[model samples]
Target: MVEITNMCRTTGCAIGDIKLYCAGFTSANLINPLIFRHLPTPNHDYCIVNNGNPLSAGAVLSFHYDNTFMYRDFSVSTVTCIS
Candidate 1:
C-alpha cells in the first residue's frame, strides 16, 4: 500500500479501469466495473476482491455482483487501494 492518504488522483485511467497498485506498486489488475462509485468521500483509491471476505472500506470498489462501489469512510477507514 502507498498510504494514499492524500495522493489520490483519478486521472489517465479509463472508466471501469482501476489504476491502483499493490505493495510494490506492481501492475494494477484492470478491473472493468459494471457499476462504480465513491464511498461518499472523493479519492482514487480502490479495492477489487473476488473472494468472500468483504472489503473493510475507504476505496472505490465495485463488487460486480453487488454492483456497489464503496469508498473510504474516513471516520473508520482510510484509503485502502487494494483488498
Candidate 2:
C-alpha cells in the first residue's frame, strides 16, 4: 500500500484550468489500479487523477489545459508505501 499527496500551482492561468500528469511504480513492479486520494488546497480547484481509470506501473500520465502558454509546478508533499 502507498499513499501520495500531490501539491501543485499554476501560473498564467487559473488553477482550475491547469492539468497535471503523473507516473507510479514500485521497484520493478508496476502498480495497476493506482489508488490515491486528492487533498484540498486553498483557492485551488484543480484535481489530479489517473485518467479516471486505474494506473499501471511505469505508465506515463499526461495533463493539458486550454491555454498551452500556462506553466504549472507540481510536488509530492507526502509519499508512503511499503518498500
Best by TM-score: 2
lDDT of 2 by residue, 1-83 (tens): 23332232322221121123322211233334323223245534333454244333334444332332333444443332211
Q: Which stretches of candidate 1 lie over 4 Å from their true place?
A: 1-41, 51-83
Clashing pairs in 2: 30-57
Off by over 4 Å in 2: 1-40, 51-54, 79-83
lDDT of each: 0.30, 0.32
What TM-score does model 2 achieve against the real structure? 0.32
